[model samples]
Target: MRAVPRPAILGSIAAVLFLACVAPEDRGTDATNLRDPWAIRAEPGDPALAAGKEIFASCASCHLADAGGRSDGTIPRLAGQRAEILEWRLRGLQDGSIDLPVMTPFARALTEAEIRQVSAYLASLPRPERIGSASGGVNERGAKLYHDRCRSCHSAEADAVAASNAPRLCGQHEAYLLRRLEDMASGNAGGAGAARAVDPAMEAIAIALSMEDRLRVSRYLARSECD
Candidate 1:
């Protein structure tokens, strides 16, 4: 497994598990919107922001200076993300529900203002340009996989929206894609209450994936537009 970042590493695992059982309604982000994530409140050369920048140095390791997520998706992209969303997730990582080994220390050291600063810093960064499948090649395979196994409810691109509680797979991270699949396949994860799209007996969907194919499909999905 990859090294967890600071204390927040465990938060990733916890988030998934919590998300598995969390009602969709409860998952709402704390921030209003992220269209201009940094505009909530701040001034150029704000002193608190400067302090937040110093504190945010640690977060940069996994989140990247741009606040974009890990290429493998171990961490979700933070740039342009909703402020409340970022705060909520950070709080989740710090308090429990989210399991991040590294973030523990990080969170412990932070003050509310620091958190806001970091959130602002992340929001201020430019959003990444997401990418996805090359062409018909990967999509063909993904399509086959979707219909034969995933299509009962998750319609095309795993985007059934209201029909199912499952998350949209269109612009998800490829690395995260692989990890979630593995977790589901292992039966260690649970989201059935939220995802009627997955058939009761469909646990084998993970087993159906070959190592190579799984990687390929995930990469394709990750590259798609998330905006």
Candidate 2:
């Protein structure tokens, strides 16, 4: 067996200790005090957009300059995501409802206005023409699964309102989708310190699907084109 490097072990220990020291209540921003994210928009040439671009620099390290995320699906693409959704998730991370370790600290550092600015900046970016995928081949079974189970909420129509705040799944990374499905099925979708309740309907759907079916669906969604 390969021995772990001392520096790597020490770094991991430091990270764990840091997270442990930060109490959920003490972490950061108040979600309730935030303004309506949907109401905020940063158009091109706006000062807010410029500020947002600066703020987004911190995020680019993980999400990438193009916000395309990693092909391995460790991260989710931020480009072309709805500002409303982005703000919502950021608020969730800030308030300890979402609980992503890497994101929580960053989200907590931002003020409500900063969140709006960054969300708008990311939304302004174009969606990736080529999204990350785990496999090259399309799964026909996955297509059927998506059409039957997911199409209603994750509509392909440009004018369609997201049902139940369901995000655009098409063009997402397959591994990320699969991981989320597995987490939802196992009642572990949210990380530690998650105060907000998980959606019962989505959880139920995830639990109902077999592992193979989840993979199929994820693969299908990854290959799909966004309008």
Candidate 3:
């Protein structure tokens, strides 16, 4: 038997205590560690709106200058997203609730006002045309799955996206949709997961989806075009 040093034992104990006792907000200022220090608003106006447009230059790389996002489903479409949805997404990233590495740093860098402004700016963009690629095959099963489970909240039509708090899924990139569906089902989604589960009902829905079901529905939605 080996003797354990008292100092080493005490240090291990201290580390455990820190992990257990420290609040999430006190951790650090990185996107995954910091909490929103001010009230989060999404409405755009005056000085903040202008400032946000200026700040958006850094985000243009992946999101595009128009914030239309990539069509391959690798990056999500931010264009025409609701301000509230944007705010929630950014907040989740900032607070470590969402695990998007690319978004976390950008969200963390913003001030409270900047968050609001950026959200508003993104929300203000006109939605781009649906150009993402979809699998070539009959999607009737996937359509049925969506109608049976997802239609009530997400709706079948494009207009429903703007009216509801939920983001538009129809005609979105298939890969992106698949990723989100899988994340939600796996309890890794930000608000839609076990960690925050801000929408517990949504969590229930997500949890109920199997991997096959997610793929089917995502492919169907991704292939859809707005009429």
lDDT of 1 by residue, 1-227 (tens): 12334336323322342123232344453223323322445566777557656655666776666555665556655555445345544555566544445445555455677567766665455566654223233455765665576655444554322322334455556666676666556664433322322233444666678776666666666555534
- Where model 3 places Cα greater than 4 Å from the true spot, the runs are 1-49, 91-109, 158-164, 190-194, 197-200, 225-227
- Candidate 1 accuracy as lDDT: 0.50
User: What's the distance in Å from true for residue 197, model 3?
Assistant: 4.6
Q: Name the 10 consecutive residues with the lowest summed lDDT in model 1.
A: 13-22
Q: C-alpha displacement of 116 in model 1, angstroms?
A: 2.4
Clashing pairs in 3: none
Tell me the spans in candidate 1 whose CA falls farther than 4 Å from its real position: 1-21, 24-51, 72-76, 99-105, 129-172, 187-217
Flag the better candidate by lDDT, 1 or 3.
3
Query: What is the alpha-carbon lDDT for the whole of candidate 2?
Result: 0.61
Best by lDDT: 2
Write the residue-wise lDDT of candidate 3 on 1-227 in tens digits.
Answer: 13322222111111111001122333333334333322234344667667667666666776677766566655666666556555645565567754445444555655667667776776666667654456766589889988898777666753233222355555666777777666656656533323442344655666788888778887887777644
Report per-prediction Cα RMSD to one decimal.
Answer: 7.6, 8.9, 13.0
Q: lDDT of each model, Cα atoms only?
A: 0.50, 0.61, 0.55
Better of 2 and 3 by TM-score: 2
| Candidate 2 C-alpha lDDT tens digits along 46-150 | 999898787767556667788776677567766776676666566666666555565556556667987678778877888777865668697889888877876
